[model samples]
Structure formats: C-alpha cells, structure tokens
Target: MRISRCVRWPAVVVAGALAATACGSFEGSTTSGSGSADNLTVSLQFTPRANYSLETDDAFVLSQVGCLETLVKYDAEAGALVPLLATEWVQTEPTAWDFTLRDGVKFQDGTDLTAAAVVASLQYLLQADAPPRAFTPKLITSVEALNDSTVRVRTPEPSALVPFRLASINTGILAPAAYTGTGIDPLSHCTGPYTPVAQTPAQSMTLEGNATYWGGNVPLKSVTARFIPEGATRATQVRTGESQIALGLPASTVPELEGDARIKVSSAFTPRTTGLYFNQSRAPFDNPDVRKAVQAAVDVESITSSVFGGQAHPAIGPFAPTEAWAPDSPPVNRNPDAARRLLTAAGYAPGQLKLTLLAYTERPEFADLAAVIQANLAEIGIDVSVQVSDYSAIEPSLLDGAYDLALLSRNHLTDIADPLGFLTADYSCGGGFNISQYCDPAIDAQLSAANTENDPQRRNAIYADVASQLQADAVTTFIAHEQTTAARLETIESFVDDPLARYAVTPDLTVSNS
Candidate 1:
C-alpha cells in the first residue's frame, strides 16, 4: 500500500508513545481524533469484486484495497492534484505524455514498482471487455516504458482529462503477477493502504494494515469492514455504536445520526443516477410522442424530496449534474393533460399502453422506486410491471433487451471532462455499457466528433446537443441522482465529505490502536 511516513518503536513502552516493544501490524500514532477505541470497524455498502475495471460500481468498496499507481493523486489538503506514485511528470505533446516514476517504490508483493508494471496495468485496462476499453483506450495507441522508472503514453489526440482519468480508482495499477484466470484477481492486487486478512459472507472482512507499504503503515492494527446492504440497519450500526463508521446511509436517516452528538454526517455529489432506459429501437419507444408522454408522467421533484428526504437531485439527462456538458433540460414535472394529448396522438388510450420494467436488488431502494414509478404511471394510462432480481440477472436482461424498460443506477467518471464517457457507452449501438441499445446516426456522429475534438467549448456544445436530442427522443426516463451519505463517530479525524471519498489520507487515518 502507498505510505507517506515511517516509524519504529523502541524496546520499552514509553508514556505518551504509540507503541512499546512488541510490534503490531497497525500503528502507534494518533492525529486529532479523540476516540481511539481498542476495536474499530467500518460498514461497507457493497460486496467486493473479483474484476476491478470491468465493474465501475465496485470502485467505492475496492478503493479501500489496493489500486493503480498513477502520476498524481487527489491532493485533498490542497484541493488539487499532487505528486504521488510518480514524483513528477512532464507533458510532452497534447496526446503524447511522459512520466518519471518515483524511485524506491515497491508493490505489496515485494515487487519494486516500475514503469514496466505500470505499462502492463494500463494494457490490461485496454484489453478488458468493458466499455472503457474500446472507447477511452481507442484514443490510445502506445504505452512505452522508456526505462525502469520512466514511462510514456501516446494517445490519438490532445487529451486534457488524461491525468484525471489516471487518478480514477478504476485505473489503479495491478501487479503483473496479480493477473489470474481470465480477468484481474482484484482481491490480490497490491497497491492500497490495506488488504484483506479474513472474509466472511454477510458479515465482515478483517483487514490488517499493510506493513511493507511505501505509503506508510495504517495506525489501526486492523479494520473490520462489514458489508451492510440494508439501509435502516446500516444507519443503526452507526447510531448505536455497533460500528464507528457507516457508508451509504439513506438521507432519510441522516437526521437520526445528526440527533446524536457522537455522530458526524458527511455527503457529496455522487456520480450516480437512477434512470429508466427504454429500448428505443422497438415498439412504443420508437415513437417520439409516446416517449414524450412517458416523460411527463412522472413528477421528479416530489419523488426525490418526499421519498429520498432531499437526498437526491432530479436527473435531466445523460451528463452528470455538475458536468459542463449537462444540458439545460430541467426535470419534466407530471403533466397529465400533456401526457394524455401525446398518448392520443400516438393512438394509445387509457390502459392501452403496457410495458415491463426490469430492476436489480443491489440497492435496497431500487425495488421501492420501481414500485412507486409503476403506481405513478398507472394514473397516466400506462401499465407497468417490475421484474426484480439480483444484479447479475438485471445486467443480462438489459443487455439482451428482454425488458421494454429498465431501472438502472449508473456511476460515472469525468472521462474527457463531460458526457463523452457515459454517452459513448450508453447511446452508441453495440457500445459496452449501452444497455438501452440506442442507435442514432446523428447522435453517434456528434459523440464521435467530440471524442477527438481538441476544443473544449466545441466538445461540450456537441455533447449538450446529444443530451437535448436524447431527451426529445425519450431514450430514457431520467430519474434522480441519489446522494451518497457517510456517517462516522465524531472522533474520526480529517473528516471531509466528498462525492469521491479518499479516507485513507485522513488525519486519523494513519493512527491505529494495537
């Protein structure tokens, strides 16, 4: 794991010292945290992954483990990018960049970190069957290791967001030896602050501090990360002191934690959205009037504020809410009158339209949303039935276009600074993440132009047009972006609420109880 500091203990226990003679796995330091309970635990929101980059949703949980070594890391202290795995890097050409790897860095498996391994890890990403492989890496032509500690990556054109993409946990480096079977054995990748010692289903994983990490040893001798998918019980774990930290607490329960002085709440703009994607190539979805009618059937504001307790924002289109490419299309409020007119224009009468919706059980809220949406649509002459199952089932269902409509929550990264990352995957036919199977030659042309375009403003305008066009076409029912909430005991230090959390660097992060 990456460490920025080092410490050693003497033979005797010294007063006010972190450790005595016996060495433990964690650490002997305390930052600003007041509570250093003998035992500490954190509740995880999802299960661990065997394949890293293939599944974007798993990044949040996997970030707790090892990841890729990049030229820079998010400098939370400075609120900008700072040197990390790479001491310093020089930008040669807009697309062709050179990096000088840090000296004396070692992987978790005793392998010295080198440019060769970094190159291999990126090649692995390019080879993956995931959408990013074909889309992002298609812009890349070569990755050459100039020396043991220097590497160069050459892309098709100028890429301003390359560094940001490098910082993504999904792009974290994997040891050359870590590759096993057909894909990455993510559980064994060596580059993080901690690694798993014991794993128990529906229970907890005892993560011991990585001692050989160059980044520095964690202060906690061990961290027990429990997988708690249940929303109410997850919050209870934090409120009742069963666990010091709870991840993904529903916003409805935030007030309960706020009521407790011992608990602190943290939240950020999550790159997640709950949406309904239509099979645009088929049936009623092919009709623009039917699509517009469906959009007007849902009341976005009430659904978010009332059901999510103000934890979510209405989604307007494919672009992330804060993205520059996000269009000005506001949430379509329920307009039964308008919906009826459109439905009639499409030759659909009351109760004449029927559609099936597919949903997954990965999130506790998906079923609830589907049920609410199904009931809501019944009032607007549409009949919907939700087919719920595990994520594995839902994924294949979406890919095969088995369901007329589907409920999906997708996480996004700032690939190329805007919707290029998501649209290329979701809107293009045969695209890796294109569950909707949507295909519009004009939309594809615009997206393709934005991909290679060097001008930022021009690219954003192109993507904005794509967003507006998709809305007008009714390719998907843009629901809302559910907020991700984190609750921790007040004793935790360096508590910064964020959309992308990097808690490993917290002030108390290095502190441990042995």
Candidate 2:
C-alpha cells in the first residue's frame, strides 16, 4: 500500500494523512481462486503515479508483486520471506553471493527470464536515480554474470542484508523489453501478471491480464482503478455497489462495513506507521522538553478508542514482533509527566506556542483524529492549528519545514526480515524518505556497524541501542502500526499478507465465479 498525504492550508499550515490505495507495482495479489466478477473494479485512495513505465514505481508493478520473485517476497500468510524469483540463495561470503535464477519463467511481455535481463534489472534498480534509488541497491558493489541463468552480486563490505534489500517495491522485477530500447534507463519495459493498459496520474489506471505470462493467465478480464480522495464517498461506493473493491477505507467506516455481510474486509498490518514527526535539527524539538510536551499532549488511549475505534492499537514502537530487526528493547513510548516537566523547564507557557499540524483529507478519520488531538493539546495549554489539503501540497511543506508540526506516515518494506533496511532509509542523513531530516553521526555509525556485522545476536544488539537512543531523544512519536482493512470479493481467495507488507496475486491460482 503506497500511503500518500493530502495537501492543504497553503502558506499558513499543512495537514497530511497516511493513505495508500493505488495498485501499480506487483505484490502477490489475487491468489488462485474464482473470479467474483468477470470484470473487477477496485478503488484506490490515490491515483497511480503513471502507467507508462515498467519502472518499479509504475502501476504494473503493483499487479506483479511477489510473483516475479527476485531474492524473496513477503508472505503474510506464513509470516516470513518466501522465494519466487530465485528458487533459493546462498551466502558466498560476507559481501558476495550468487543467485541461481528460477528456470522456465517468462515475463508477462513474453520474454524469457535470462541472466542478462536479470543483471540489467538488478543494475538498473540499484543504480537508477529514480524512486528505486531509495532502495540503495548501490550497497551492492558489483555484479557478475555467471551463466545464462546465474549472476553473482558482490558488496564492497561484509553484509548479509544484501538479498533482503532486493525484496522492496523498488526492486520489483523488470522485463527484458523494459531494458533493450531504453538507453540504460530501466524505467521502461514491463513485467507482471497484468499488462498495463493505461494510466493517468491523479486520475485512474486500467489493466489487462497477460495470457502469455509464464506464471499463468489472470481470471478477471479487466481491472480498472479509480482514484477517489473522499473517504466517505468511497465507502458509500462500496455500499451502493458502484465499486467492487474499495482500498484504504477509513477506520471509522469499517464498523458499518463489518455489519454489511455483502462485504468482506481482508486486512493485515502494513510495514508502515502513522506518527508525529519531530525536526530534531531545529528548536523546541531540539529541546527534549518541547518534544515531550507534544508527546504528553497526545492521548493514544483516546486516539485509539475514539478515533481508531477497535481498528488499531496505541503504537508503542515501530516494528511489530514480526520484523526481524524489531528491537528487543523498544523505546519508552509514554512519558506524559516527563513531557510536562520538560515543557515547564523549556520555558513554554500554555497556548503561547502555537504550531501547525499537517495532514491530508483523503482519510477523514485522520482529520478527525487531528481535531481530537488539537482539543487534547489545548487542554495541556498547547495551541495547535489544523491544516488539511490534497497530497500535492503536503510534500513540499514537509521538505521546507513550512509548518511547525506535520502529521505524516511512512510505508516501508521488511524485505530482509530486519530493521537494517528500513532504519537505514529512515535515518540516513539525506535518505530517500528521511522526512525528519534527522542527522546523528552516532546513530549512523551504529547503523553502519550493524550492516557489517554478520553475527545475528550482536547486530540486533546494535540496532536495539540505536532504537533506544531515538526513543530517549523523542526523535519521533511512534503511533499505531496499522492493520489495513481491505475488502476482497468472496470470489477472491488466495490473497494473503506476508507480515512484511508484500502480497502476491499470481495467475497460477484459478478464479471461479461460483
């Protein structure tokens, strides 16, 4: 799920929410089952970025998730990383290993999956200056084409997390064609269960199944995705039968849906978190007390019960017990009294400090939650201004530090079964999605040390220490690790979550109307 924030409030304030509703990159989707409808229409919270490229971020990649298999794909059902692309992998050394490609597989584009193509896709993703660049495949030092279906990937240093990085969305497999004509640009060519029909950013996307796909042919003849930002209206569409599958339904609407037997919600925890971001590089937040005051003002018990209802839990930390890198000692999540003392010592007066809270309006529940928070903060003597808008405006607001505070969310992959990949992305000084812009040399040193340590217990200890310090710094307020509420028609069977956030809907699974 690619959660995006809405932009609003212009220069005064910016409000945002975490809502991912588009499907363009491949994850295991639509398992072997019967079609609920000859044609299926699913509604996403946001429109796809584009349907034009076979690039990992493109819409088709959503359709082929977990199937094209590289090193591994998240299997929610089994709660582990399973193989799809490479049958299996072995560690040659700390920094080097060879992947023996799965044989007899063909791309949806009908091209064979060869060693050269694999090499190309791997290199393109790791080296490309695009979204996949966020994957930092550059951690890989070199690639060696061992044979027609074999390639050796080498890292400059001893690192066991190499293959795990390849399981991210940005690492979705690419077709040979996405390479040939594209001048070293791996963004074109395509691969997945369904071929891209067409896509218009901020509008909609349509897809068709590839009959010649090596995995198998799709059941539904067509899939059209509409981008609808209004949460209530989208929920109504599900109720009225205008939309068959509604992705990213607000938590508040879930209860009503649960009452409607006609609908079935298939939900799982996404490796994502909804939280309060602190600009550690700047003031008040730079003062531990101010950060704590904000934390104290947040009533997660109230937030969870009133706003989230029964849908979510008050988040104590980021990684669920499922993550390989989940800290054995999670950060201290609650310190309301300490928060008060910190604010008092920081010389802050109630209502004296007014800050902007940024969020998007697509998920109305979050907007409502912000209102609740605003009221709660007011009780604590902190004044907060609420700003809400479309996703377009919220991003720059984050980068420019236009608002004193912003409501943000992150969707990441546990591709390697550890915190190494996600922590690196979230903490790197100039990371791809380091919204907080947190730059701590000490933290970075710890992360780097963990990366090079091949010993499991020792590495986890290092990561745990990093997590502890961040907690002490109140670097960020950790909220609930959301368990998504997604509805699949009864005809939908094999859909499962890999706990790690990746899913697969391959064609090998049969779909019947029943």
Candidate 3:
C-alpha cells in the first residue's frame, strides 16, 4: 500500500493567516451510530442516481459499500486487471474469452458461485432496459457456461479490452435470486464481504458483514454508507465523529480536516479530468472556431490554484499526465487575444454571444470554477450565464444537447479502467454518454484502430493520436486532472484509498477501539 500525501499544509497556513479559525468546529451533527468500535459508518459523495440497479451506475454504490464483486478488478497501482471472482482468464480466440471462476466461492444467499450463475448475471445486464454503456449488445454477442467453473464470453468484434470491460462494476455477478420482476435486488444475493440489509432511497444503506465470505473472515461487523451529495456535509460528518470514513471531500474542507488530530486525510492522483464540455450539435459551439475560442479563454492554471487550492494538476488532455497512456505535451496556456480573434472569425461580435454554462452543485468547486470561467470568457467579449443544479437534474439536458456548455468531472477509468472505454463512450459518433455531442470521423477511425490493437504499446499510440485530435478540435477543454481525497478516522485500520473510486469497504477493513 503506497500512499501519496497531498502537499496542502502550506495552503492551510495561507488560509489560516487570511481567516483565523477558518476550520470551525462541527458540533450537533446527526451521527450514524453510537461510535461503536466494530460498527463503521462511511459518508459517500454520490447517492444512488438510479434505483440501486446493478445495470446502472448505481452498481458503483454497491461496490463502494463492499456489497458487489466483479469477475475481475482493476489494480490501479499495478495498472493491470487482477483476479476477483475469476481466478484466471485466457483469450481463447480473437473475439472470445474464457474465464475460470474461483472455486469454493459462495453468495451471501448461501448459493455456491458457478459458471451458470455468472452467465445468468451477465445475461441480465445484456437484456437490461438501458444496457451498460461499457459493453452493450454491439460489443458482446453471447455468454455461455462452458462448465460448472468456466464461463465463455463472445464478442461481436475482436476486443482486447474484454477483460477490462468485465471488470466494470455494472457487470458484477449476483445470485440468481437477485433478479426480480420489478428490478435487480442485491440484498443477500452478492458474493462480496458485506450483505446489504436495508436501504433508504437516495439517503443511506446498511450492510452486515458476510461471515461466510469466500475471501476470509470479514473484519468489520457492520457498515453503513450514508450518501450525502454535499461534500461539506460529508466532511463535517467525518470531522464530528458521525462517520468513520468520508469519500470525496471538497478541496475547501481539506484544510479544516487536516487540523483534526483524530482524522487522517489521504489524497492520490486519479484518472479523472474536470472539463467544460460544449454541445457541438448546437450553436455557437457548432462552429469549431467558437469551440476553440472558448477553449482559449479558459484559465486552467488559475482555477487549479484558486478553486482546487493547488490540490490538482492542470490537465494536458482528457487523460492525466501521470497516466501511462497520456501524451507527452506541454500544457495549453490561456490566450484571450487568440480567443477574441477566433470569435471574430466565427462571426461573433464583442458581447454578441450569450451562452449558458451549466454546473452541478454536487461538486462544490464547480460553482467556483464556473465563476472564474465566466469572468475569463467575459474578458473575450462572451457574455456567460451560469446555472447550478444537481447533476441528476442536469444530465438529461446534457445528454439531449439542450444546454450550451456544461462542467463535468468525469472519471475515464470508472466504466472500464482503460482509455478505450472513455474514448468510445464519450467521443464516438454514436457514443452513449457523449454529453459534448461531438463527432469527428477521423477521431472515430483512430479509436477503432486502438480497439483492435492488442499490443499495449501500439494501442497506446493509437489513443495518443486520438488525444491529440481531441485537443486540436477543442471538443472539450480539459480543466484539471483531479486527485481523489478521502478522510478517515485514525482508528480505522487497513483503510486503502482506491484511485479508481471503486471499492472502499473491504474484507480487511477494521476499526480499532484504542
């Protein structure tokens, strides 16, 4: 377990000097429990946007609470796919993969994990109302149980990323009983360390440790995950001892948490990028020059310093510079003069272009970042209006191209821990999650080439070309590569920070009374 500590103490000193006692005390907050040693409460950043469905992004909620397990898991540190429910896998053919399931594994429902069960779970996802964005029917064609211990998956095309696709939490295996007439019920039907017992819609969920977990004896007796969308509230819960662990603390709250002796704040660079996406299908962004002009107007360095408090690195592209696949290039500097010139070329006079910039309040820094961008764009004669709302309320408008510009914090590795998944789902002509409404045949061609290239170096080269094309087109102005910050009580032992933001509570996590 390597930990990368964030150098935020200097910023704390600066903050303290400006405002004395800025790190105010959090008292009288609602606590999760009586602060029991064996009982752990975690504050999560996102509530279940969907109805806790395994087929949607809500699967991540299940994984974070240790109630879901995928066949394979991404080892962010190792930068490779590792075994989870599946012990080993082999590419038997260009379009086919055979995964050997681990023996002696049992679902919390008391059913033994089998190849048939794995096939059933995947089949459920394939037949879902809105299939998983990672691997839909377009990608995967069939799933068959070769034996009691082996499952074979066949894709429509030769995909080297099949293993990584299976690693997505949306494909998490569950017992057959989980599939109900209404929807998938994960309670007591998963093969993870914890079994979800109760849930309050969009609020909180309670889970009890699976004593018969295949991995080993679960260390924590119980775990409760309270989904608080407000980052400050999550931080306050951890600070006031209402929660033992908190995920996704805003940068503004880090200094305050650092002042607490009982709390340990851990930060690590992740494969996430915060960017302002343009609705390419609509005007004035329909014009490439306008998109470029907006890109040139953004002051990424200032936003990184002021809003993130130097906690994040300015992004060079969609992928983080620290990632192996990221292109080796210089950061794009803001050029307001060029922005003015480009806007003129796009036939927009000074103060003629009025645009709406939408940002979600879930990420508190987004509001601050939007203000800075609004000011920057105004300098180049673009009049911008900002709208702040919950992400759930804005997603429909984003996907339908109803908005002009949107601020989004996207994790490239969340769907599949590879660049291909992000590239295909977010930039392709018919991308499922293409909020930008961007489409370029040249970039799509590069993505196709990367999808088929099995060789790691060659595949990365194709993606590098795609990244270059995306930047040149100004499809979205990548603001900064964010680092995930988590705060946990000092008493929590073996608390590992997942750079991928997948698994949080695990079998080895425990609490110490002393």
Q: Best-fitting candidate, measured by lDDT? A: 3
Q: Which lDDT value does model 3 have at 420?
A: 81
Q: Please list the C-alpha lDDT of all candidates, in the order they appear.
A: 0.64, 0.60, 0.83
Per-residue CA lDDT of model 3 for 1-514, tens digit only, reads 1136431101001011112110101112233652777799999888786656777778888899998999988776656667899987888887898889999999998999999999999998888777888868888999999999999999988877788888999999989888776666778989999988877667788888899999998887788889898999998998888888989878999888888888899888777899999988878998999999988999999999999988888889897765657778777889999999999999999999999999998798999999999999999999999999888999889988899989999988788877888888999998889988878887888888887776777777787778877888898899999988889988998987787788899888889987
> How much is the lDDT of residue 442 in candidate 2?
82
Q: Indicate whether candidate 2 or candidate 3 has the larger lDDT.
A: 3
Per-residue lDDT value at 460 in model 1: 73
In model 1, the Cα lDDT at residue 72 comes to 59
Candidate 1 structure quality by residue, lDDT tens digits, 1-514: 0012111111111111011100112222321212354345776666644334433544445465333344556542333445667765555776766767777777766688889999887776676656352335666677889999888878777664455455655556667776664554544355666655555543555555567767775556566776666767778887776677777667667787888887777766565677887877688888878878878887777778876777788888765546656678776777878988999999998998889988765566777778888877888889998888767656766777776888877654433124566677788764667777778887877777776665667777887788788877778888887666778776665544444443432314532332
Clash totals for all candidate models: 11, 49, 0
Residue runs of model 3 more than 4 Å from their true location after superposition: 1-31
Q: How many residue-pair clashes does candidate 3 contain?
A: 0
